[model samples]
Target chain A: MVKEQIKPMTSRERVLAGLRREPVDRTPVCNPTSVATVELMDLVDAHFPEANRNPEMMARLAATGYTEIGFDSIMPVFSIIQESSALGCKMQWEQKDNWPTVRMREPIWRDVEDVVIPNDFLTHPDTACVIECIKILKKEYGDDVAIIGKTMGPWTLGYHCFGVEPFLLMSLDDPGKTKLALERMKEATIQFGMAQIEAGADALTVPDHATGDLVSGEYYDRYLKDMHAEFVDLLPVPLILHICGRTVDRMNSIAETGIAAFHFDSKNKPQESMDIIEDRISLVGNINNPETLYAKGPDAVRDEVCANLDAGVHMVGPECAIPLQTAIENLTAIPNAVKEWHSRRESH
Target chain B: MADLQDISNEKIRQEIEEFVENPDEIERNIETFARVRPLMQEIAAALIEGDDGTVDALTKQALEDKIDALEIMDDGLIAAMGVVGIKFRDNYIFVPEVLACARAMKAGMAYIEPILSASGVEPLATVIMGMVKGDLHDIGKNLCIMMLRGSGFNVVDLGVDTSDDEFIDAVEEHSAPILGMSALLTTTMPNMGKTIEAFIDADMRDDVKIMVGGAPVTQEFADDMGADAYGKDALECVAVAKGFLSVQA
Candidate 1:
């Protein structure tokens, strides 16, 4: 294998190089979702539901990804609810230990016509929190660590605003109406996405839960592909598109969308995922969240990291969002494993 | 095997074909119906078709006509649900389809509950179920509850964010043989272990067998948490619940 003898890169340079699928000194560790842990919350004095709403707390907690754990990028938006909350959906911002969820059971919008991008969508405290968090991270760690921001995709926004059942039923019962809803909803994606970019995010992790089990490959082709491709033009930043669950079926369709990378889940095997995308876009993630990281020790965590690096995934990190109570040593094992694997290769 | 396409009642067959997507699963569903009485076949077909009103009406009329409620439940709702479970497990169908089937089964079970209770026809087992503390996700948990009920287990659902004491309290109150915990988020999964430790602390761990499941849960995690059983989906949850009953028996 031809290896680069380039000088060592900063975490920011490595991440941006990874996004561009360029050669870096080593593979950059980028978690397009989150890596927040309760232990980290205690260390940084940034706790959830509040960290999700407070820009400084959010930035402090997010910086632990780079500052404490040595991830190549610092992702400030830990939760998926910021856009949903700002859009007027009711929220269940649970205790400090739990994830703040949208009250999706009580959907805010029933029809496309009922949907409104309130003038305050961006400036609303929840939305502003994310923008402000990115700005703070950029100000503090701008030159050293990649500040990756997150924006919810229209499909996920559809689930929050219309509720999961009604939205899935809509997709099944009326394709035209679902398309209309997605088209109307895509604006929100571009809106928050551009807002974060303007706030100085090196790239964006747009989590659209068009997940594998609920939606199909054909569904991706029909509903999300063009919109994602359109996002490439609109967001004007390298997008690490994230969809959870076993998503091997849609990787081919996703590769055609012009996004920079696919932030995939552990449910997908790293080797099979790499083969599916055919290197059309950068691939990141595959470390298991629940079993390998949360439940097991660092050895198990290192094994998964090594597997993803071996599969030639461009960047590596937890597949979905970090489970909040996951142990600290398990989190650090991610970058530790990545560096070890590359070092062994260099020795050869 | 003669083709499932050979079955009469194109209405029921078409419904089965639409909702039961895999060819092998479609054949199995046809055989489940073909082997049962015509009335039971009608009920099973209605359940698969997710026509809760039809299941409700058919169940009510069958009981009025003196058809054994057990036959209607076993031959009808449970049999149909087995197919729904298979389709969902196999990824040939998804949440919407399974939910419709669950509601259809619930509609049928509504009639069976009173008859079984009044006749002293004991349920499969009383099972305590809940989402672990700090995890509000319940789509998978709700689906498992419906499946357990369809399979004749009387389940007491504690809803989401259930504290550890609540799980022990439910088990003791109901004298249940099985307890199932679910958590969709990885962060909240440790609560399953914490709840198990709570049972051990209360000195009631021996009273009820524990089973854990959810989206991110796996057999290895379940074992690590010291759970007696782990189910990947709602279908498997029923099997695990039954397995727990046999272990107690």
Candidate 2:
């Protein structure tokens, strides 16, 4: 039994309390998404390009998300290249300051017939590193700060695996072939997801780019709805479904998928997004990353935090994986704003 | 075989249209590619042969047949993407299709760049672009550069992890009026503000309009940082650049 009059203690405590939907003394400033900071890059000696691929370095930088920056969770494997890299796509490892990207000039799976998830997929160095990082975090932090693991959704992986152009062509040319490719990619999603869960991750962020960008809400309903629902059912832990870009159009269906929470983007306003998906799901965001978190000062970060708290978001965070260069002062101010808001509310 | 010849031109035309409306179709249907290859080769031959009227008629027929402008880049692929961008903004198309069209446009652009440069057509604006200091994320930056180039801006890409001095010097050398800064991380985003402050301290604020973007940026933050604009993404950056130039006019 919990007392209604209890006040929030710390960000860690506030987040755990919120996981149960219990009334916290204040809002929690947990980034269930990536919180890569430059300080961490130097601290770990594993910067971008390498951290974007190598598991050991990936874990080190991810650890800074919790140990160094005071974020409530550590998210390893920052980029979305695992499935594509494993699927044999050519990657351009630009340099330290740039995250590695799939070179789309030559897509791996030229045709639907060529698409297949590798058998030794789990043992792949990058995939193995993500699982290892989660396991290591679980061992180190135990249950103190949640360890959020990322497994690219099959659709997103499909974008990199077959090259965006080839995949889109298959989607239009032969719908069945596109379905075939997605079906194969799902094995990678499920296998990686289960591995992370087994590796001691408290939660898993299933990032499927089901934005209104390339695919329609109808596409999500038709392809991902059932798979996501099943993932939630089988995973046996909180699943945070993160989709980039404006996704308000699919709030109804996303809520219906039984995900514990939806990590949203700034493209959708916090109040409007909350109004749309409040009761159906636990809303986690609406902070404008580019304008507020990335470009402004701590003052602006605090303002956005208070606004999100006012909008009744179950959790407040950056709209997405925060850029590596975001000011630490802006991020550290998140917890402070939540605390001030609660204190003001209590006094009133 | 007789029907193949009877409808060869029509078949090539239809294939070209599918290639235009959906660039993905060009990769999937090998037969369509084979059929169109000869016609495209003939058009290239005609262009080489100096048969202007024949090339014009074939190009128009190809377009009517639904030839993607990208496939006919020596023809006018930019016009096709312009159509795609309009359709995209109007909600008639989606991201994947737009991406496909962009790819097609890129392919065509590759073929046309040298020729276009030789024609002495000046770009609308000269823009300096880069990912801000301490941030390595470049998707948003690259996309903006592509869009800027597509929209007729002479883009000087400074690559990722650029320091304030690098930006100031680039502006000095290129005489660029717009400095587009991007940061994908919250930590790096503040660098945008710092960079803008550098420009101001150098008394270059009046000379350049600073535009900031990436996942974490907002318009309010841009205003707070004294940046001229905050583009939500690459597309918005184009509109902002165009608007800024218009204001100059």
Q: Pick the candidate with the highest DockQ.
A: 1
Write model 1 residue lDDT over A183-253, tens digit each, in one string.
98888888998999999999999899888767777889989999999999988889999999989999999
Q: Residue-wise lDDT of candidate 2 within B1-249, one digit each (tens)?
A: 122233334434453343335444333223333434454644543432224455566656665776654456422443334444445554555655555555555544554566557767777879999988856546557767777787788899998779999999999899999989998655566678889889889988799988988865778778887899999866688888988899321
Encode model 2's per-residue lDDT on A72-101: one tens digit a residue: 667786777776777678776656544566
lDDT of 1: 0.87
Error of 1 at A154 (Å): 2.1
List each candidate's DockQ score.
0.49, 0.26
DockQ of candidate 2 compared with the true complex: 0.26
Candidate 1 colliding pairs: none
Instruction: List the global CA lDDT of all models.
Output: 0.87, 0.71
If you superpose only chain B onto the true chain B, what TM-score does each candidate give?
0.88, 0.66
